[model samples]
Target: MKPHRYEEFRDLHRAGAPLLLPNAWDHASAAALATAGFRAVGTTSLGVAAAAGLPDGTGATRAETVRLARGLSRLDALVSVDIEGGFSECPEEVAALAAELADAGIVGVNIEDGRPDGTLRDLSHQCEILRAVRESVAGGLFVNARTDTYWLPGAGQAPETGERLDAYRRAGADGVFVPGLRDLRIISELTSGLTDTPLNTLHAPEGPSVPELAEAGVRRVSCGSLLFRAALGAAVAAARSLSVSADIPSYAETQALAGAFA
Candidate 1:
């Protein structure tokens, strides 16, 4: 990665407008996004796992995550990876994975506190993992600490959200991500409470727009699994459209898209 890429990615969060980050699954998706003028891209753990026929958010795709990171290093756009729960319960192991991703030219990573069994990880242990990852990357990687307070069923309330985020910030997280959080009022409160630490939230199609999110003080808006899921839907639609004919990219065009990175 370019020495300034990390700083460049960081600056996006501080810009006047909120950063609209799209997540990609593989080289073609990432390269296509970059070619279409997206400055930064992130990998969706669901996309990575599903593409490899594995389960997502269950520590089944660590090797696939790392391998995809290495391949994404070739893309022109800045890249961040979603490492679901860091694939381990050990802080040291999670830190080592972060380090390896940094070495692979990943500018950032999203390590969530959500676990495989539909529950959140212990706050103290999650903080330790964040601290270890932060120290491992030496500030070279943007560690976006993700909390599942809003994602997991009956996890906690709004007050707990602020508390967890506060602990993560103190643990050296560069940013805090809250997926499934859509209330503008609560989002504003969280951003206000966070102060300088960027607040990232997943974009919901039925929720707020980018401008609405920006106005609510969200520094980063992630597409999460939306794009991957949309792609799957599109593929099915295209197959069904065979009779009516669809305007899908030709084989050569698809090859050229992948070849851009090559």
Candidate 2:
């Protein structure tokens, strides 16, 4: 990645309006999003894993994630990869993976604290991994520390969520992410608590709009796995009736979109 690319990606969070980030599953989806004018693109681990017949959040897609990141480096838009639990328990291994992605031209990464067996990692160990990754990137990558407190069963209370986010920020996370959190009051409270650090939340169709989220102090909104799932739904619908009336892209257009990267 270029020296200034990190700053460019970071600036999007502080640009007044919240950044509406769409997660892409592969090269074609990412390229299409870039063509549609999204400045930054993120990868959804669920999409990546499912596309490869692997399970999500099980630390089983490290090779596939790295390969996709390398391929996405060819795009003009900035890319952030989701490396679930950094794919290892050792801090050094996670840091090595972050450095490798940075060398591959990825400007950012989202490392979550959620484990594969439906539990969160130990707080201290999670912070250690964050610190190691921060040191490895040397400010050249935006490390968005993700805590799946609300995402897991029996959604963690706000107190624990705030505590974890604070520890992550102190551990050198450039930004913080909490998926499956939809309460506006709690979102406002968390944002107010972490005044300096940017807060990212997942966008839900039934939830507040982008402007509402920005008003609540969210700096970034991620469309995690929504686009990929919607694509699948559209494909099935078209196959079922052959008259879905969706604006499907032409074969030549898709070919051109994919060929541009070549």
Candidate 3:
């Protein structure tokens, strides 16, 4: 039986504590993390769509997203999907997608408020969708309301981030996510108005450490596509360096890697 992991994760957030959510691109990544002892795993939309050769947040990979979620459900961790903008502009449509995710054994979903079309979806519209989604899942899924205020190019992102989170909390979101905001001072400021709702931050390379983010009152930290991207970069760099240098990967190193595939 699939574990009712959502309730446990939800309760973790409710305790004014931190939950470090590692984003997995596919089954192997998720299963490895689960075996390594993660209680929960989040799917990075960037990692997901990029693997499928579709643009993230474009509604082009809905089928791929569902397939991946289905596969990850076999793991032991609570799975939370990043369903960018819920794949539709309509509230009912978003809610329907949430229902499908729930039926797939997804314990939670993260839906953003900004669209790829370069404008913020009206907070009211986002709230309507959130409410609809909350109502649809009778078993209570964790709805993480993500704000692209910082990720999107803009000068007014900070203020917009705070406003969006405030609205999301009032709309009954279990958590709020700001993907690109990493400063401790700014994070503290932004999370002040959101009472009871956990603040979720994306893990940045130059951002505050996990302990620091926890101290800053962030309840969740997600490594969104960083590991996958880093792996790709490392592979390409290894090939390039080996071509120019004598210190290439040894016979045993190459054999060990090849043996795994074999």
Candidate 4:
């Protein structure tokens, strides 16, 4: 692979088989997924921020996010990073970061409209960021435009979601993503309405499953931060259980379990 190919990503999306993207927070997590046969891996903004001791969705971890992308760039997996709101409102600044990610061998990124302050950026502003990244990245990197309309509760969701996707597509996004859309009817409608554009949807326990989304014409299924969060919860539960039970994973045992990564 040339380490960058939007067409490869586009072809995968057009396959309609549900491209499953596992969001990895670190080198081991990403390398493990690559070794386990995932064709592509994405970095969860939540995971990246939390691991770096920063609040996610706040665009406060740009340096850490870029650093992690640089690390994952060394692996063989196709890489796409979740750059929370492009880490800045300035379109060109986001473009510079996208160029850095591309130089590090990442093939794609998810830039959302939601800001850390819990308010969504304006459509024009979001589109400007998308266009800047597209123009800066030399057409080889996939830019997944993510709208917060579906994720955040508010008025004018349905129309706003569609409008944002349209603007983002016009701004040169390779795919449009709605992270919290779970209704089958809405998913079908979105896919039908945007027939020429690829759709990416986030999947969690309560969301539509991969099979359902594939049937609904969703091209990419992103795990976001669910896997990482689950791992955290499991570790906490295991430790709590050990405090009251005889079962325990010692340091050596934990190392043994992690030997595959080693």
Candidate 5:
């Protein structure tokens, strides 16, 4: 059973046929997204933390994060929990958390090496965390190791990115994610460095299209926090529009929309 689900998640990352992951912040959003036809749903750390009025990527949302993952696991879509920095620096603790998530039926997890102070965790330490997680879950979880070199200031170029990803893949990461990296040249350079390890990139509206990324060798395109933000924007816009027009949505219309989740 574990292998079956794990393979299903892993197979979604195909070179030239990337998985377009839509991130959700809560059960309602995740359910709505699954109802909308997404096979998998990733939780955005930013969306989850912000919705709960906590700081994201700062080890403040551990309980909330776990609870959300547990809830989402029961949904129709495969759930991937974004555990910022594994919610601890200790590799053993991170592995324990991953074990719990695996027991909860989560198929994937996104663990990053970026510190809240805008620095990357040392390559060796991050690799240890990945290795421990890989050992703990025993191939049941799709560990998407994330490197934030491009997302941080004063970070080095492809040489450093490739070095870290190479170590991460060697450390047993099922896939590698580089958020904030949009350059086709850099992306191509980085992907070329990996040997069969799926390259995951954050989807950028102004960046390369899916086909372009496929050509560049990206196997997974994640919409991290974009959908959550868009939902917030739509809600605010709808309220403002109603105020400006002095109009209230009809009871029938409200019920119809609400019933989608029910």
Candidate 6:
């Protein structure tokens, strides 16, 4: 009953070393990331939702998320799906979805408790979702329980962060993700509070670097919508530059950048 992919992903969260998870939006993006030597790739919910003309965190891109997961799972990398709020409030439904993703070759899933209406779900309910998903996957999938206490304005204070993360770990969460947190002191405090679960934080260009986060006890750094947004910005800037400067990137350089995905 050894879950090879699950153990591999779990091992990526090595205490203070931290794994760098660059999220992908589509097949090409994912393939490119894998080609770039990233061992694991996660899907950004915003990238998938916005690309489909739907608002994020509103359960609007369930089908697109699943389709993307199915495709990305085939890549030569461990795939994790960012299933915002589990795409349902019901624990049973969320568990079912997790099972489906596991069957589709997804080794991990990030489930958040923040609602689209600018509110976080009750702690008890979120724990229920985590527990159900853990049971459904049965160690075959890594359930990264995500708490938006710091992301949602007026949600709660720092102490609440530890409480929620501790509760999530007790409810069978393999890892805990707290995005929108950048302070190194606070990151260290939260990470120190967790004994069994690994701490995951969002990556910010203006904030602490990956090395700094690892020093602060973070076990995983997720580049959540950053890569997707950067890719979009790069596309627009490249197009604009072509109109202004005749010195565009050489075809060989572009092909090299595309690597095997090309």
- Please report the candidate that would top TM-score against the real structure: 2
Candidate 6, residues 29-108: lDDT per residue as tens digits? 78778877999999999999988899999999999999888887778889999999989999999999999999988999
TM-score of each: 0.96, 0.97, 0.87, 0.90, 0.92, 0.92
Model 5 / residue 228 / CA error / Å: 1.0
What does the lDDT come to for candidate 5?
Answer: 0.89
CA lDDT, every prediction?
0.91, 0.93, 0.81, 0.83, 0.89, 0.89
Model 2, which residues run further than 4 Å from truth? 244-246
Error of 2 at 150 (Å): 0.4
lDDT of 4 by residue, 102-182 (tens): 877788999999876677898888888999998998677888999988776573578788888888999999899998888
**Could you give me the TM-score of model 2 versus the true structure?**
0.97
User: Total clashing residue pairs per candidate?
Assistant: 0, 0, 0, 0, 0, 0
| Model 1: residue 207 alpha-carbon error in angstroms | 0.3
Per-residue lDDT of model 5, residues 63-106, tens digit only: 99999898887786788999999999999999999999998889
Once superposed on the true structure, which residue ranges of model 1 sit more than 4 Å away at CA?
A: 243-247
In terms of lDDT, which candidate is strongest?
2
Point out where model 4 deviates above 4 Å. Answer: 1-4, 243-262
lDDT of 3 by residue, 131-218 (tens): 9998888555889999888887772587777888988888878899998887889888876778788999889888889888887889
For model 4 the TM-score comes to 0.90
Model 3, position 174: C-alpha lDDT score: 86
TM-score of 6: 0.92
- What TM value does model 3 have? 0.87
Local lDDT at 140 for model 1: 85
